[model samples]
Target: MCSCILLAALKNADEMLKDIISAVDTSGDGKIQYEEFRVFVEAAERQLLQLFRSIDRDKDGRLNKEELQAAFRRAGLSVPKRRLSGFFDEIDLNHDGFITFDEWRDFLLFMPTNHNGSPLEAAFSFYSSIVTVNPEGDSLVSDETLEGLGYFLAGAVSGGVSRTATAPLDRLKVYLLVNTKTSSNVAIAAAKQGRPLVALRNAGGPIVDAIVSLWKAGGLRTFFAGKLLLGWSRVLSGTDSHAGNGLNVVKIMPESAIRFGSYEASKRFLAAYEGHNDPTQISTVSKFIAGGIGGMTAQFCVYPIDTLKFRLQCETVKGGPQGNALLLRTARKMWADGGLRAAYRGLGLGLVGMFPYSAIDIGTFELLKKSYTRAVARYYGIHEDDAQLSNVATAVLGATSGALGATIVYPLNVLRTRLQTQGTAMHPPTYTGIVDVATRTVRNEGVRGLYKGLTPNLLKVAPALSITWVCYENMKSLLKL
Candidate 1:
């Protein structure tokens, strides 16, 4: 129960002293008794260890004020450079300036963050509350609920990243999909005169290039276009299948017991259909459940972005300096001609696309990882005792499995793109109907035409999918749930 051990895990010297005092002074006597203080010291040591690993800078077992500032910076705070001079002054309720373990504990226990402060601080407070509630397994509830918490965190983090990086590409994609009809009208006069279309507008580049070019022509703002939503879509669909598949391999799969006010009836049906904890009874069907649920959830939530994308692409490009008005014009046009239903042109195709894309990608990835993990463990003679080594191996195997799965599901990517791009275009898809769309693609482009972008799709998705599984497995082990 030495003071050093209790505070050793905290590199931030300010919080350390406060934590010590909070732990020791539990009695209402406003003083520390020898027996009670000793017990408090022991509890603080365990907690400090967890917090240190959670935020320690260099594994050196000590922290200074500068290191604490670095941790805040890593968490994306924009504190001023000189704030460390009295960093703990406000947080240290005991006026010690340097917090012992007890004072740190007391400050954390009653840090009133909700009704005031910057948005960033509020978000941090919310995130901290969640981690506190579900530190390990969220065993305060069932494993399924804990898994749900994992999904929430995964989506928030991954979705945010995805939205930022891919927004431009998605905007470009939508732009191209909508502009061909407008172009067809422009080229009407050229066609009559037997003249070639302008060089840049020739539509002869790689098809994706065409999509991007049209987006630039239309000049839409980045606006997250569809990137943010699409990223979460990836994680949600990935988490649903990947997590469940991994859980299934366990001796006993976890069932979700938490339910909201009216979801209980539906949950019962879901449980009934899923056979209620009978892992042996689950087959390929179970894998699709998560993909469908995740995709549908993500897609519906961001349908407006999808609509804006289409509007940006499809508006007629009237000549003169006013073409930028395409947005207002498209909105007005859609409003005058069609309502909400107009924005949902490809809704049917989305549902159809979700199942195969999610199922093929996630199911295949998890299955491959499962096989690879077993083979490696068998060949290398891995044992339960080698926990750390086994975990590293699992991540590697999961990544490999993801690559293989992406390759297997390559065709689905083409189908998904076609479903999104075709039919709903400024004009209908090339076919008179869905059957015609299929036949014409095969007839003109050959059978491989249906999978025009297969290679590129695999290249894009393989690492992404692999990383998703690797992340999920690593997180599971880290949580030790």
Candidate 2:
């Protein structure tokens, strides 16, 4: 069995090497010249630099054994102590106890051609050594477990970064969403209150007016309100009361991790069910279903946190619990009102929106990526299997998918925001349920009321998804996933 596995791995490695060589051999000379080799080396070096930087948390430019071990653990690839010691011994050329960039690069570059023994063999040996022996002496870690960790980490980091960067726009969107009145009404109210920038209402439109209002109310800080949670702060500061403020990284990280992780898992399951061993062979409909399932799962798990975020953002518009205790106060109030049910006030509507939103978002992105790669391959007369999308292409596809998905389910988003924010301290519950909310919104604010906050939402979704996919893809590449 081990021999068969080794042979299969070697065969796959050969095929992969041929594809890599074909991709790098742009001139079609059937041979790699100095310049082509130089270009490939440069690109590989850049990828290595990214990986090195990620692993080098202290940024001192050298990777200690502990750092490498930590990085492996973080990526979900656990190496046994004996295997890790062997790896370190092989890579640490100078025996100086640290692996420098040069040593690391050389070892990887020489891995495929090492005459004494290939690292691929070492990998198989390592895997074999780590597996638990069953009654028949055959127990290996499943492929599913091996494949999920890097994606989870990538999704988490991307989600945190994108959410933090677009926090202001996100906050504004929630505010506008729950506000429900027209831009004209807001402008009129602002003018009556002698608020700043009422004169520019007609010139700059609702979005600009909203920004000015938020700014005038609390200056630049209000744009990022509710971002920093008291719980996170307390944990960071080692305080007992869990009262503090800061970025919403914690809320978004797990949400994103679950999203991408589940999406990948679902795709694998669907592919296996359909008898398609290759991921690239999965149908578009399967991708859509997987994406929807992923989105729904993530949304359901994190609905309470999302509700808190929306409530906190809306607090600026409506009076509510304030300051570092805002999150705790909000949670206490929700529990006091209806226990766990209140925390998930708009969860049904959110799930409704999430299905179509995530389906379209992920489905469109995957479809576009495959199509774009094929088109580029055809245009350049290269093998389609060897074609790869550039970063710019990935970003454009991400933005397009995000905008399309958000637009389709935008009305549901508005309704969800309203449902979540209702019955708060400042604003009494105006609508009883989803039906009442939709009916009252359409009746009082007209059809356009359901589309409130679409502007800032699009503004946030485009770049946010774009950055997310870009970062995620880059991280995956660096992790060799």
Candidate 3:
């Protein structure tokens, strides 16, 4: 297993070098002259400068042994102080006890070609090189380094962007979700408010009436009523899933990172355990199974934050001051009610939903992407893997998978939200368990009740997921991820 992963990593490294060469060989000469090499190095120098500044957290012009050790730790590696000191001694060519920008740049530029060792050592060396590049230094930026930075930034920003952009739809979904029992009454009340739009209610079904009522009662702003509350609640949790609809791209960013990372890690470990090093011989189901496991792993890490965010969205507020503190108050009330357990209500159901949701979402996306890539490759006469799908294909496929996965197991989501918000000061505990929630929802509001807020949910999720995939893919291409 270890040998297999090592071989894979080495193969990846070789491909990476090829990509770097292609990117730097601007003249199409097949061979890079000294001048071409200088241009590539110069471009890399910019990233090295950023890296230097990062390591020099104190804004100092030099990096000490301590700083180098800290950088190693930042790159997900742990190195002994003694080893780092020896490494620094070699890097500090002037015997100056500290590494200057020039020395740092020279070390990276003159990196040893025979540094490859065991996979673990190679991984360690790779990450150390990555985190050591600071803005204050004069190191060169490799295409790979730039690509990595791009993925990190893209994942972080895309989540918040998708969540915040669809905030209005999410707010509507939550409103309908918590008020399903009283949705009709609320629409009637809105009609009684003498808004001219009330006439539309008579022409439509209950869902349409509710929407019209909400519009008449509050106009455009009503759609984004508690955005602040939702954002703050999610932010404070330091986890993702603050979108009020449980689909936060930001949180999913880390979730994705974890999912993919864990999948690879698990694959390597499993192959090692089974004594199978041949990569091509792996089963196709491995990807789907790995994806499902990865999703569950991510869900476990962020489910509590998700629960809190859901409860806050499902809060039954009635004409009180809507301030930022409401989130804190709600959190405190949950703490007072059942301690930590209250915040984790419905976690079981969430995990159950997550398993299949993650499996289908990731598997379907991969299958579609590959199929699209293959078709495009055939049309364009290119390698299948090298084929590029248009933005429309990426968006449509992403939206379809998201909508399908969410719809397939939507009842679990609805039940989870209800369980979290139930028994709160505002919304009393009605259902006893998952079964109870399901039974009561069906008994009280008919089968359709289990799908409350689904309209706005699909509206919000389809585009949000689409945006996430589009942004992620585009960013990956831009960074060459």
Candidate 4:
């Protein structure tokens, strides 16, 4: 028959392919049936068993930790000791501290096989390729490295976009924070200038006055004055630009990366110490502590740049420095004034506020997300693990959490900004220390003074946090974290 001729030609085309097909076609009828396929799978499993026995060097019929490590080495794979231990523990399903032949066979068989190699070879090759060393004998691919990269890229993109989008609000906040002039005074001044519309805009409130003033100084461009340069500088040089617009991706990237990376790392460390294999199973208090630690670490590393950015933002009110050399000039001046101390002026207060703020922000978001997932699962009659929150829900949760954090820390932020701006050419040294700043602010403007610019701050922070969380989660998913 024609079919018989075609089958014969197919079998003759490649010897290796014909052998594979024939191995699975145990019926020897040049066609594979269910019974024949089942027999082939049994044969493959038996071969896996043979491979396992070959690696059981002591002939104890079980693989101890040492033997398992030796097998990987013989396969020309180098794994971290910690990772190997985890692997070993996972395979020792009964917690017996050793892998029996049955366990080994089950693990090997679960791995997807490749046509080019046996199941055992495919599994080993896949594991080996997961973590690799470059020509310089340094680790080039690993879980930690990949996770950090994911955070870094996500942070950079989210920070840049969010900051750019909320730049006007940010500028308004900084302006209101630094300038103590009341809205009434601004309105009266504009009225005297015979600009009725300007006076009306100023009369709307401090937020309106700040917006109008910024607009008059440089039109609409003033809102995003320093952001463009910051973006360009990030692309051209790896260094951050002291742009007051808060769009410095180079600056934000490292801080965001460290914050998220350290948070995950801290959670893992705590989970291990608490005898939990999964970090997500850790307690809420533990999550809060981990988030606080991560926030502190990130704040410490970027505090100086933050101080510089605040100072630069304040400068926009007076139209101080401009162009590429602005950051260097500012740094040099700060160093000349008080050396390293000047650069870290409000760091103490910053840390104090950051701890609780970060703790609540991250912890609340996690708690909400967990509850949301559970509720969704319950409603749909599905497993909790199978439920996922929509992107809009994620953004809303992030915004709510961020707003709460920002509100709690707004007073400290105000004090820090005041302290950083003090002793500059415009605002003379009015406070001697943190206490002095707090005392003067409360003494002069009452309790509400501590919350100066809270409105614009909320406006800026809510969207920024929402955008940040959405982008970060999406990026993590993209990178398969």
Cα lDDT tens digits, model 4, 1-481, are 2222222344233443455576777678899899887776687678778777877898989988877767765654444455567566655668888888776655444343444654445655433442354333455566556556666676667666677777777767877777654334577788999988888976657776677887766666567654543555542463333344333554566777778877888887888888744577789999999889888988999888777766666555445555445656666777876888987888899999898898988888999999999999999997665587778999999999999999999999899888887766435555789999999888877787888889989988899899888887777666655
Worst 10 residues of 4 by lDDT: 1-10
The C-alpha local distance difference test score for the whole of candidate 3 amounts to 0.63
The residue pairs found clashing in candidate 2 are 228-246
Which should have the higher lDDT, number 1 or number 4? 4
Give the alpha carbon lDDT tens digit for every residue of 308-385 in model 3: 666665553444323345556667777876887877788899889887887777667777887788788999897554
Candidate closest to the true structure, highest lDDT: 2
Tens digit of per-residue lDDT, candidate 2, span 1-481: 2222332344234543665577678798899898997887777566656777887889999988778767665554535444455566666778999878886666554222222433334333333433323334355564346558777888888887787788788878876777755445555667778875864454347777788888765666677774533336653554422122343655688889999999988888897889844455689999999999999999998888777766666555423334555656666766886788877888899999999999999999999999998999999997564577788989899999999999999999988888877876434555678999999999978998888888889999999999999999888776656
RMSD of each: 16.4, 14.2, 15.3, 14.0
lDDT of 3 at 294: 65
**Which parts of model 3 have CA positions greater than 4 angstroms off?**
1-153, 180-204, 208-222, 225-284, 316-318
Which of candidates 3 and 4 is the stronger one according to lDDT? Answer: 4
| TM accuracy, model 2 | 0.67
Compose the digit string of candidate 1's lDDT tens values, residues 1-481.
2224323333443443554456567775667798886676456446544554444466655444555555555555543333333344433445644444454444343232232644335433432333332323332453345545554444344333323443444444344323232223334455566766653354334555554544454434332322333333432344321111111111011111111101222333454687653222244455445444545545555444455444434332323112224434555555554467555545655556654555555455445555565566777787312213344554455445445644554444344444443433343553333455556566655565555534444443444443444454444444432
Q: Which candidate has the highest TM-score of all?
A: 4
lDDT for predicted candidate 4 compared with the true structure? 0.71
For each candidate, what TM-score against the reference?
A: 0.44, 0.67, 0.59, 0.68
lDDT of each: 0.42, 0.72, 0.63, 0.71
